[model samples]
Target chain A: MASARSDRRISADHIPVKLVIAGPFGVGKTTIVGALSEIEPLNTEEVLTQAGTLVDDLTGVNEKTTTTTAIDFGRLTLPGVVLYLFGAPGQTRFQVLWDELVRGALGVLVLADTRRIDDSFAVLDLVENAGIRYAVAVNHFPDSPQYPPEALRQALDLDPRTPLLVCDARDPASARASLIALVEHIRELVLS
Target chain B: MTSGRQRRRVVPDYMAAARLSVPEHISVERTTLVSIAADADAGGLDPPASHLLALLRDEPLSVYECAAHLGLPYCVVRLLVAGLVGNGTLLTRDPPPSDLPDIEILELVLSGLRAL
Candidate 1:
């Protein structure tokens, strides 16, 4: 499957909608891409080393090896649309790559882990600073407290227009709904 | 394959900015343009995305050319293009990439030079 994707990328005819999946470490960016992508996702990842302990937060994700280095690339087809999803790695060290992942994106789906919502503030800030519209999704961890949308909004200080929702990340249907909200939000921004 | 209109871009002005940044006059060349979806992790990408994929399947188009054709605002277009290039969907043989936030660059350069 990976080899097949290699050839397809070279074909000079496949245009992809570039969507960025951003959140803090272990917020399920790679896993979501893997679940939704029609093609075998391409990940540029390296396992975390002991040296990384100084920088990467290892609080909840002691087991995450092979953290994405550059981006996690996936292909998903939505009816007539072919979405090329790029899951941005969570580490602050790789913020250099954020601009690339952002290109051609019409909107953003920012995942926030309720257990570590604090970690997400910076990612949300980056997206907001870029001036492109975005929506927030709370990736519900087993331990993450389920808060009302309004409470989450106040916690995140989200703009009234920003769509705030929750998802399991493991569920395909729920994930799809979140993306649909993003598209709608983009349309609203454009029209306004 | 020729491109087709799926829907109108809200702001062609964004594409215009991206097109102006490029130093080329090609009527058409393949370029990697970005499409942002809201809940990609949850799966809500736009419908026109297929057209976008078909547009970038092969070669890297100049920022200049994409804007003129797509008619999006240049600033918005540039933002998207920069992000896509960052993601490795496109490449430029010249100038490498300059999307490093200007502040970060200044700090890196200043720090390096001072250390030297």
Candidate 2:
């Protein structure tokens, strides 16, 4: 594959490809991107005023005077391809921007925390609704109870084909594995 | 509680100042990448727009990246980028790609990750 792509380097005219890394707050979405990014991830913030708060469901979130929506991004450049990994903001209020963010994304990686399993639902729903193929990565947290693969899969009510695996977001190798799973899933979708 | 948007009735000084130079018709996407157009005259642009031209003189950058580099708010940078794009001082690039990665590239990416 590398030999085949040697001649396909992305030009200034070609659109840059992106893959979204999504999950709820405190789920290590940024950590995963940071681990995988070759350069230090860049975080871009947008101010969310009180009017924006009305639509946000901040149940598990810490209190804040003025909400700052942040999206962290990293880039991976190969011989012929330039892929960007963008971490999606976890808050529901930021849903307004999802369409724009996901507009040209290749696929999405939805990180799930076993402790807050339900927290992944909203993001999963958004990805599914966007008609983007996605894979769920259960971020391995020390305190979270461990479950069998089937149990975790059933809890998330995932499609039998959806890839689900446990990964340590802080570890680059583990994070890359999750991304690989997502890319493979995207390939399957395309081929089918 | 008074809403933050409702309470901040007085326009910010910078915004008021920018209103003098930036026209209203210009609009920009949050993620738009802006680069200086070949015909643009940096000296004729507003201070903010001039700074943008300097930043993009070498290469294009997304409006979000510009905001971070300029230490300005995203909305403020968007306005600046929009103004430049509207006046033909700046040009926008192709949007991000939505298609699947090429089979060869996808395999290569997976292999590269494994090798790393």
Candidate 3:
């Protein structure tokens, strides 16, 4: 009976996977991770005092108070599968730290606030520079006018094979759907 | 509102460099940060050093503690501390508190975080 149980556990070992949520400053990378995680999320946050404004970019996140300093982490478990979610550090200067964060992640979910689309480019470039597979989630802001998906694709210069979808970072259902799209994209990569 | 000019006085590079020197065994270069700040602020304090000085005001903490106080990481602190200490605003004693465990210190940090 012990041997049988051990064999069953061994088969279950590889069920869960890791997914990363990455984006630029103030783009809700942590919010998306928290919304989907089954467990209480752990994040390292620091107040974005006036001092940071001089050093880090403050174009879109002008009114921001705090930002992730280290990583924000959460977990989502499925039937015999667990998805570990990690939120990347939000500053461009912190780009050097990504290799360690993305080490074992299966794929990345790149969040973009349509109000400030250019901010997303830094994150997308980092993922591409690292040669990891990623999908983009355009988190809608209330005032952001809708635009054609293809136009956004061209604007961001996204590859044809990369998945791009709309999401409301504040809504769990919408965030979950975006993550599912990322999972499906990764699976498709495997199949190909 | 932001001021275009920062306050600068008569502080020479050698004096700035001598005071900021850290005797710690850590791999950080305390002197290089001063030159960068001198270059950027045109011989005035760079904005990031203000954040680091606030952290150093309390104690000769590790690179990690400075990061926590600023809501940043050792990466940010390492850069800023090297500059401030090199410029004589703060002093760094490196080689760190030895590898030997200090149970009391661990409990104090945990207690501090809990209190926070």
Candidate 4:
């Protein structure tokens, strides 16, 4: 079976592919990771150095030199590769963390909440400025209002090339489709 | 009624405990994959390095996962991993290329996701 082969491949050598699932707080980033991760999602605390402050300070005194944040991640083993999905905090204050998280990542999926659509702008800007390919997945909550695809695209101010879709983070199939959309978007960019 | 509040301990200086300096290229990202070296000799390794080796011996894990399992901060784990890597006791693989991956890899991932 593919699972047996994948297990053996992982023990041996296989490519490690990383993708970021980033959005504002309470945007279901962790939920999507939990739904798609083969094993339970794990959270780890990361320390972000205040490099900007450290560099800008002429005096030796530099308070608040570091900030720690907990990031959740999940792993999925493909045939000969292990795909790691990192659920990252999308607030402006966590921009330093975003710089580190997106390093060497294949792409990013920005999860958005329709009710709080404005919260996703910072993440979208971060990814765009980083010059990395990304797709936006609007995680539909039971109580949130729904909008047409075109309206969401305009509201989010997504580029024409960017892929936008709605997903239910609780359902595996739905979550998987969101990921597939992101990958397909990446493929398009690579082929273009 | 007894006070339910407990005092918080001061954060430890992880940098002070670091014995080896990490390389410029080695990142502390949670997704960076790490594995044990094929010819790793377990003897005489420090507790933290030995523990990291044992964890990887079972199976390769990301630096973040190592921290989670060992109850250490990500910065401390990166230093420990760097120590192991410096001594050729462990191997590290950075996450996929910074730019878009090759078309073939993207295809493989898409197919895999589709199958799921």
Candidate 5:
């Protein structure tokens, strides 16, 4: 029985899937991950130093200087598989890290805030350019203006094939719905 | 907003060289759980690399976790991990997402989320 159980146990090679929650600053990306993750989210942070300034491209974030950005992570373990949910660090300068971050990831979940929809464009572009399959979920804020799905689709220039979902990062059910939608989309992609 | 002034870009070549100085074989992948090899006395490791091996003597930890615990930059930790992997002083496994989780496990995971 012990040997049989070992055959079915989860290991490094058995099933390792990473799903990235990506968006611009203040889009509740970490909140969503916290809602779904089994334990308290762990964060990886690096101080912004003088040398780091050279490598980081601070386009929209010109006003900020002294800040530490963190990559938040949560895990889900199954019998023979484990899923990791990572909140991508929000900073254009961290672009170099994205390649390493997305390595071995199954797909991406792009979260957008209606208040500032344009912030998501960069995240979408990066994920698309990386050739990773992704789904977009709009994190609805109470103060943000609401638009129809088609209107958002036009603004974001989303291909019809991509899935757009509505989510409330604070709510467990809402966040789970968004993840389930993305998972279905991933399944569809695999089938096709 | 340049105000018609041609400002010089401060190029920190030393910093670049230092951070990007990973050995040729060290690829940038999210590191796996790493432990010190039995041959801890292997020579030629830099101070930081040797220190990293010493820290790992207790238990294996992921590169990111180690960086957080040590308060070091991710790039530096990555370089050390790569160097150790190259010299066989550290052992690592491939990252996750290769296996299938049965529906029961998925449900349990979902339940965990629901509890939160």
Candidate 6:
């Protein structure tokens, strides 16, 4: 039975590419992943061990050694390559986890909610500090105010060369356009 | 969230089995893709390792997917994957280049996205 089962399996090689979607807690990071992903988004938990010194010590000797954080991700298959979209945990406490997530990523897409545009500051800093290329896509809500590209860029204090665009996280075409813009930006940087 | 925090005090039963030591050089992340080695000998592996191999035999998967499917902690699955990699029982595809991908790959990705 085992041999037969093994025979049915086909061995194929594929290169895995990672792209991260980052934003504040309610910035629709997961929604963007769901929109672009071919499969249902999957959730995985990572066990983070906070340093002993960092934890609060109500009992004097801290015993809280570990905490688990959930990361939602989705996959897309393209020819010989597979694209993985990871929704980064939005809390400030997961700085270490952010480092791991972006270690070898192609680029990051920072989603912003116009109503809470300030919430994206911390995430932008994290992405910049990591030295990875990134773009900002303001997720448009019906009630949120709309501004010109240059005005929004100025408000966010983004670098002139950085790609800034607007998208609707719930719309597949809009989400895909944001991703394409990010890739084009990365390509431009590489060529330059 | 409360249950996850509460469960940390007691080691889960799944982790009580013999611990597999991961090598120093092998780094397992949620995005790291793993596949079974071409000439792997599947005999004599522990149940977890065997199960991991069985899963990978069908198609390559990221470490997170493997952990989720096995119902084990991400850390435990990392060690299991690292151990398998150390013994040449599996192969790993590192994540995309840290800086920027090659122009050709980027173009391919752009075309693929456009086509979709």
lDDT tens digits, residues B1-116, model 4? 10111111122335325465666666545766899888988898766776677777768888877776666667777777877788788888866675758887888789878866
* Chain B TM-score, one value per candidate, order as shown: 0.37, 0.63, 0.41, 0.76, 0.58, 0.79
Which candidate achieves the best TM-score against the true structure? Answer: 4
Query: Where's the lowest-lDDT run of ten residues in candidate 4 chain A?
Result: A55-64
Model 2: TM-score, first chain: 0.83
Per-residue lDDT of candidate 5, residues A1-192 (tens digit): 796545433343334456788887668877888887664666665444456555544454445453335677776554544567888854565777776677767678899988778878889878877788789999987777889999999999999989999899988789888877776666666656
lDDT of 3 by residue, A1-192 (tens): 795433222111223245678987778877777787654565433334445546666566766765445466665433333345778854566665677556545678898877788777788778888777789988887777688999899888999999999998888888877876776666566556
lDDT of 2 at A149: 97
Between candidates 2 and 4, the lDDT winner = 4
| Better candidate number, 1 or 4, judged by lDDT | 4
The C-alpha stretches of model 5 lying farther than 4 A from their native spots are A1-14, A47-68, A90-93, B1-24, B35-61, B83-90, B96-116
**lDDT (C-alpha, whole model) for all candidates:** 0.56, 0.70, 0.57, 0.76, 0.66, 0.77
Ranking by lDDT: 6, 4, 2, 5, 3, 1
Per-prediction CA RMSD (Å) = 17.2, 6.8, 15.5, 7.8, 9.3, 7.5
Model 3 docking category:
incorrect
Write candidate 5's Cα lDDT for B12-97 as tens digits. 22332363345786653554656666665657755566556666765555566555554555666777687768767777655544
Note the chain A TM-score of all models in turn: 0.84, 0.83, 0.84, 0.84, 0.82, 0.82
Query: Each candidate's interface RMSD, rounded to one decimal?
Result: 17.7, 6.5, 19.8, 5.3, 8.2, 3.6
TM-score of each: 0.57, 0.74, 0.56, 0.83, 0.66, 0.83
Worst 10 residues of 3 chain A by lDDT: A7-16
Candidate 1 lDDT over B20-44, as tens digits, reads 3342332221124333332223133
Candidate 3 residue runs with Cα over 4 Å from true position: A1-16, A45-53, B1-116
